[model samples]
Target: MGTKFTFYEFFAGAGMARAGLSDGWECLFANDSDELKQLSYADNWAGEDVDPRDVALVKASDLDGMADMGWASFPCQDLSQAGPKLGMGKAGSDALTRSGALWPFLDIIRDLATEGRHPILLALENVVGLLSSNGGADFHAICSTLSDIGYRFGAIVADASYFVPQSRPRVFIVALRREVPVPGALRGEFPVNPWHSKILLRARASLPDTDAANWVWWDPGAPPAKRLKELHDLLDLSDDADWNSDEQTERFVGMMTNSHLARLAEAQTAGRPMIGSLYFRMRPDSNGKNVQRAEIAFGETLGCLRTPKGGASRPRIITVDGDRVRTRLVTMREAASLMGLEENFNLPPTYHEAFKLIGDGVVPAVVRFLAERLLEPLASHGRAYAEAAAIQKASA
Candidate 1:
């Protein structure tokens, strides 16, 4: 064998990183706390041995002898807008304090470094809110800490829309050891910034001229990448999964109608022209719970997928036709399709688990994008390290 690169995945929920990295790297260890997710992961990677233990409860000392690369898609409950904004504090003290799981990640890195078993590469994923949390103080702290630990960090905000139909945007950080010289010349050109020109102009008007650096100017002339997939294109309607109960469907429709009416009344009260009716549907689970709901927007694309939290739930949808008819909720297969999982990717035995996994899992296409553009370039360095070790042993 030439060389084998090893991977240790932390917070490896349902093996999103595993799905993306397994083909490119050998996974030596994986961990997660959810039993359902663990079962799903085991089912997905049938032959791979993964231990479904709680990482927060596991000692870093136990990981002293395994893996060469570490990949963590830690729980973003503390960093996500969906959760509390506890930027690196203990969970449960407050809603904001609940979102700070970044510390656990750092703790693992610190332990690995202390034992001189620092992985060659470290990759982390989280919500974009992490960048501006605590007025960017949290981001600074994270970068500074990693630098102190002898790692050079680079980050990018990649949108799933680039490869999948959904508009899920996430922040990814890749940290490499300081001893490794980054191939700066091979760094891809920065993606063109895309924002509504009117929004940018309005934002600049609010800022002082001295603070021009804070304003982002959109390049209207730049040719953007093609908008590749659509919400409908990813659905596998043939699958008999993800149906809601009649009661749940009625409740969802009622909620959507009420929300739509509220918006319509608000527009009328503001003297704005009333748009057509917002069509929506209820996506049911096997147990008849309304796991997901979809609403059609006036003309814009489908709103981002989010966890359904009762009030004003789910992303908004736009209606294509002029008639203002209501629509049904998105199907389970559609959700899976939108997430870019393979057509037959492990279907949870229950609707609730299915929605949870889809909501929590990383989009496969986004993972593939990282693998090709970011991770593959570092492969040669890993191979070189392995080869050097082999030569040293042979000479000895």
Candidate 2:
């Protein structure tokens, strides 16, 4: 495809973001340091021009050309609500923490600006914890950098459940050059609706006046319709034979609490097909000691997929259809569907490897939504915006 638009995918695990931006957009460069992820990425898109170096080692001169858009789904292990909450004190330092990975990505953008090739659009995706990390200082730093570098941006908290069968809520910091044309319809005069939560508003209020003034309450319109496929819709045929055995399924059911057992009993009496996602997690008991608990969704949708913990930490699918009840761990193919990946996109052969790739990706459909609503419309204006940014910077 001739380059009508282009993007650079940073922290590009398996190139899932590239897949979303595939139509009408060409990837100018892609980079990731994880060896296995690099292999999968290369396998999908011929590895000829992909950058395999760590983000810290990459120089701006290494990039192919200025891109219309840039996407960075940085590591969230240090910023997740349930994570270490270590924040960004060590970001950009020699420290080897996953959260610190954000600094290197920013460095690439900052360096590119020195060469007068800053991408017109930028989207950074991570967990909602980014909004509150280190008492909002982490997010403030991100916003400050965007404004300092000649862009106006906004943050949106959108959940994957709105478009897929999984519940994954993430924050996307969408930025555009000051010169790009943003339709009035796309800019909300005030924050509103499913996109802006109370937490996000609080975070925005904490920003310094200079940085906050450049923030836009961007509206990407409505998310796609609620999932067309329910949890059971993606299941393989019951006869395919990968399900857990009778004894194993019995043991898993035994881990359920009385209330959960009652809910199952009600479903059993109703004599209808039902499916639920099951997670084995540790919760504090009445005595304040942590104990393993099996939790299932109240709705038919699956729980959020997460980086797997090897043995017992993955969420499994449990289906009950009248006299027939079956239990099985979610398969690699199903995980792809849950993440809005194309059917049979090249996931790794092993269970954990494939799960990790999908679990830590930006949903293709979600990216497509942002690209179509904003990035695509702004692509043609990228060169114009870049020139204007350069002129303004030079005059300063």
Candidate 3:
């Protein structure tokens, strides 16, 4: 490869994000704490630089070499919508250190800066809940820290539904180290663009105006996504495998609310084939009763895949064919497809492992699209600087 841009994947879970950077760039280093994930990464990726250690314990010397970009999809459990809403607000305490795993990544970045080899671009991915956690204070604190370290930050709220069949809305932060004047005041009207949602707007408003100097609104012109009539469009031949038992199917239906049951009945009685994906959540129903309700999506879109921690955490497929409602847990391969992974990607050994690996990942297609746009300007600038320096040396 000729001068390929390289990146370090911090929190590189099973090399999924690295899979996204396969086309134009290469991974210089990868790190994650979980050994199971590390085994998956090693099995799938041939990179020898894979480091399986807690990020907090990783030293700056370990990442001494320079790279063009750094990708961090840090743990969002503490800040996720489904998990504890402990935002990254703690300063120096253990709770802060634990809940805000972003701190260790920040410390490493600071070390890189000290080494005078900081990556030109730093991209972070996390759940959208990061913006609202601690009333938007967590995100602002991150912005402030990035600004302090001489990097200008830009962010966008992107949804995997735009690229894949799953609705995974994540906040992506792209920070660049460049000199620029203070960003102008926020416009009176913040447009509800695809890249900026209401939550993003509120998060931006929380930051001090001074921090805006390095803040940019990143918008890559996204083409309209193709509409899906059914979830089968994204399914593979291997996804046809069913693992649900009779008792399991009954339990799943029993969890559905009356309204959902009626809808299923109506769809079945319509005398046509109706295919949908189901997700269970223990929440309130229309009758103000707390119960496990089966939420079905009729279109190509499916709900976000989460780690299979509980019965509700796993996604199930509901197919209504000629008055028969057949249900089965979505196959692991189907979960991989939903994550936009390549067909030939090596999956983990067990079903739960495979599902977990894909579920807690940045969709590969989305990452490739975003990373390409984010690197364009930086690449051009680097090339221009190198050419100028060459011309000066030649003249001398």
Candidate 4:
């Protein structure tokens, strides 16, 4: 136990945070509402029983003596672009009321702080849409609430392509207790100053001023030379893998073609649709290597993997061999690979469930990057605070 730190994970879906943090800290307790997720979590990590209860069921009082860090990757339904834009209000019939989940986290933080036994660090994860939720009101409320609880915080948007083959982009927030003095006077500014070059380049073109606001701008001067991973890097690519059949492949092609045609007909030449672009550039290729061996190109990053609806759907693979284009639907293992999981990352027995799990979960490599680079620095600052406090007490 070199420098023991305990963790309490709320909304611990599939335990990605636990996987990342376990290397540096001890996960004392975990909580989530989904039973299937709990089962999956148990299968991967031993020790620490997951309290398989709705977030509301867990009392903040119960966590009084538990841990040193509080981690929450709360449900992002209300804050994600994919969900209906219901910011902390009544959820539509089809929408998940993610706004309701905030209270549990707030309660736990408030309760622990009142007892003077609060965790020194708090971390949160969510979609980028959180920044603009309710015209930024929700973001203001969240930050203000954390500030009121005596925590100084900041956030950064990191893309999975920086570390892994996936293009999954997520926002990670790191907060430190006010009592713990930050290393420099200018705390609450983004910790990682040197961001990925691509982001800096985008910022340079998109933002008004380089230093007008405290926002970290990506510097075009430091362009990354190495190309990001594509569909192939994400795929397991095992010889034994099964691929889709000819009938299924044809059905997908037909459906995509139909969808593309509709968009093309509706759009003007100046306002061409993404579907139209995909269709016009479409090529023919083998369905898959076998029943499961679906291969995509390594030239371009794969599109975001969404929950499969009706019909046989997955990412489309485009092969370029001397201008002769070949296309096929991606496979389950390939889909898993796109989410930044290892080839051997476990999945549920059911294919639908496995797809759902991958879509819902955070990219492990992205989480690990945050843990090591971002969270670890903040936690290290906490250690410095503890050391100074001990010294002051001794002098007194």
Candidate 5:
């Protein structure tokens, strides 16, 4: 691990990916537009500074030196299912959507190429909705553009639940420069489970043959599954735990449907400590009116964390034991833990502010898994390594 793999992080939300990249990795540059999020990034990373400026105004000359990898988890709002479905802004037009931040990021990468400083590895992370947004036109553009920029790329749909407690499924576009020799062990001839889902396959199939030819079927392999924690274990269930009043909890529980109510009843009589995570969503009633519903999951895996935009929906931790009932907003520290951050990572005091950072960012553990399995090897190994792996793959 003596050799450090240097990276430039764009849309570097509190350096979540940096924390995931772990040891033997060095961040040479980072940037984000939100000053508030930048403050959070500064708090966690001692001595490492962030360029807190709009990506549009950031010129390629602003970047320094060569990097082994350049990662941009550009704004996902425009492409997220929960967000307004605005496509990546027009290529050259000044009109930009929220996710248009990717345009400038690509511009910088293109500029770096003119200076003959192309980062051998490049990755783009975003919501899985990107694959189908605008009737799959957006996905086609993504593949074509990467091919146009001289990259052999592929998409992987990895769920955060594989490594963490939350169920956030994100799309990672992993690419290598067209001239680079790829380790055969890093990819496969066919799409497989855990990374390539049917939706992703359909997207690839829809690609023009020229674009499809540039696609590599990534096989990063399955995660060593962690012991799935019960909600009783992940959260503090003691009587002294931070909790809302019984009245508030009872009122919230009253909003549950009969099916959810039955689960609550089971928790009340489970003869032991039983906790549930609650995510509120608007659902239709018998008459078709969209009524607010308090959906509860008794299992350990919590629902995905959503960005705090417009009105923030704060998730609640609920537990009902015998005659006792309680519910409380999920704390900032808990949110950090669920994102697989170490206890030392800095977080904002308020729940919404902290969620804004954690919700929009990639899970660090997920990133670490990919780095260990593929990215690091690609950055560190050479042509001989690729050839040897190819031989081994063929024999197997």
Candidate 6:
């Protein structure tokens, strides 16, 4: 075994996973299709290892080396709540077509298998919606398929709130090649811990019993996270900064329903200073009319940042302190901080592009937490794989 663990990253947008893992691990290769993200990634990494192309077009032969781990933060749009519910394997369905982007990743693994080159560990990240997508059938198929390919899968649902001020919950899957077993007996249900959320519990219950046998429900032996800074801490702009104009603020306020305005007024009237974050959601009103309602969270963590496809994508900040009320769009730096990116991390000059990069990327601190816990088990069996590979080469 070498002194350091290494990994290859797919869907490596803005290198957020890399930012998390960079401290303790080496990134051997990376791939992403978005050119703007590639620009941001290049600004930070500046290496030849980044392959800026669609994953489907990258041939197996292109992956010419081996690493200790493989990380894929696959696209979640096809499997998320806001997207169509077409299951992963449905024929001629757009959902299947889009989610099938995972096939190239599987193909790379298969290629490594053909060459007797297998990484001891693999990590997959996606939205929590994946667990219930297509009536939990898609999640089932993913576990079954990985098992078929000689991997034992373990999954946990983690939220970025533990590491940052955003409430982004995501499903993380860690897979080990069948040859390597974790220290303890693999169980389908682990004793509940601080990491156990209702969403995770429901997702666990939905897995097929047969597949559960191969499932390692890992318990991160850590206490619940302590509360960090509040939503107000994420606001980096000065009071005199150029933000929403008075007319624009009035226009946005007019777009909200009476109930939302009432909530804002109540918060503004509160004796204690309160900070609120706003995001628009399409919800049904009392008369069964689907209206765009502006939702606000006061003096709490901001909502999850998302790609700016619609009104829900951009989160607005509202601060009310001692009869003073202010509102403005969240800056790129603030979004980066919410994702646990470093202060010196490079960001695109363009606001929309930077926001998209931050929105689409994973929380580095969350990735680092998983990486630290996973390294020991992964390293313990590393020698065995090396020996097996050497023996096969000698025989050949």
RMSD of each candidate relative to the true structure: 8.8, 2.9, 3.9, 8.6, 4.5, 3.4
For each candidate, the alpha-carbon lDDT, in order, equals 0.60, 0.82, 0.76, 0.60, 0.82, 0.75
Select the stronger candidate by lDDT from 2 and 5: 5
**Consecutive 10-residue window with the lowest summed lDDT within model 5:** 227-236
**For candidate 6, what is the TM-score?**
0.87
lDDT head-to-head 1 vs 6, winner: 6
Could you tally the backbone clashes for each prediction?
17, 0, 1, 9, 0, 0
lDDT of 5 by residue, 1-396 (tens): 577988899999899988888867888889998987789888988856799888888887887887888999988888987888987866666888878788788888888877967677898999998898888987888788778777899989999888777788999999888777778899899998979988998899899999999999989987766734434455666668788787877788888999998988888888976666787779999999999988788765777888766442776777767878788877777777778788888888876788889888899888988999988888876433445767989999
Compared with the true structure, model 3 gives a TM-score of 0.87
Maximum-lDDT candidate? 5
Q: Give a tens-digit lDDT track for model 3, residues 175-238.
A: 8766423223321233447888888888887789879766777656653466332257666424
Query: In model 4, which runs have C-alpha deviations exceeding 4 angstroms?
Result: 64-66, 90-96, 185-230, 236-299, 309-316, 320-329
Q: What is candidate 4's lDDT per residue for 158-231, written digit by digit as tens?
A: 66665555556776666778777655533433333334234323432343332223232211122134535544
TM-score of each: 0.71, 0.91, 0.87, 0.73, 0.91, 0.87
Question: With candidate 6 superimposed using the best TM-score fit, by how many Å does residue 101's alpha carbon deviate from the native?
Answer: 1.3
What TM-score number comes out for model 4? 0.73
Candidate 1 local lDDT, 264-339, one digit each (tens): 4444454432222233456565687875443434321344566555434533332222222223455566667777
Candidate 2 residues 237-328, lDDT tens each? 46684988888888878888887788777767776777887778787877998888776654656888888866777768777777666788
Worst 10 residues of 3 by lDDT: 180-189
lDDT of 6 by residue, 1-396 (tens): 446777888998889998888656778778988888777788898644479888867766777567888899988778777667554554223444566567678767867777867677789998888787877777877787677677888777888887788888888888888776565623335645555567667766777787776777776667345745555566665767657776776666776777778877898778877767877788887899998766677756777888777545677887666556667888788888888888899988977778878777899888877766664455456656567878999999
Give the worst 10-residue stretch by lDDT in candidate 4.
272-281
